[model samples]
Target: MSLLLETLTTGDRITFICTGLLGLGVLALLSRPKVVAAEDGVTVTNLTTTRRLDWAQIVRVNLRSGDAWVHLDLSDGTSLPAMGIQPGIARDRAIADARALRALVEAHGTGHSAT
Candidate 1:
């Protein structure tokens, strides 16, 4: 490995470093945050935290215009951001996903207490 590193020209080394940095940037953006829906609940995993909420604890799912992603309104008077449904290049797809999530919340989150 040391021999290989020593054989590269300055330009080649710069190119290699730039490519590696660009790859890392793409990876970081792709790994930002996400949400997952299971049989009984949804999980929101962000860069720093992962939160799981049962269906009964969710009051509604909101994806208003101009918003970056879906938001979950909980019965506990707090809201959680669903980063999986982000808006940007795929706005229509994101809207569709938000609708599907709303349907899931409505189907399974009604008539139950947050206890």
Candidate 2:
């Protein structure tokens, strides 16, 4: 009887350990950084807080191959990777969003080629 009890206790301990690890992994994913482009500028946020950037400071915008990126280039030659935009995963929306961003960049007079 004691041997059976020991086995049950061990199993419970293992289950509890696995559950804890899974919970931590979920938290990490939810806490990932996300970026958004608004009317005034762009905003970068994460589980902790948010950041904002004005449109005038933007240099260029890049559309990458993956399904989870929408980067914005700054005037200082720095690139800011954005989130909440996964066009590659959804072809229709991705192409539309890319076109809109390209138009906005060109309108702002950055003079960058869209190749």
Give me the candidate number with maximum lDDT.
1
Per-model TM against the reference: 0.71, 0.58
Tens digits of lDDT, candidate 2, 6-108: 7777779789899999999888866676555667666766555566777677676677565366666777788666554457567677666666666766775
Tell me the TM-score of model 1.
0.71
| lDDT for predicted candidate 2 compared with the true structure | 0.66
Q: Which stretches of candidate 1 lie over 4 Å from their true place?
A: 1-26, 111-115
In candidate 2, position 40 carries an lDDT of: 69
Best by TM-score: 1
Q: Write the per-residue lDDT of candidate 1 for residues 1-115, one digit (tens) a residue.
A: 9999889999999999999999998788768788889999999887667899999888878878888877888888998887878877489888888777777877888722221
- Report clash pairs, candidate 1: none
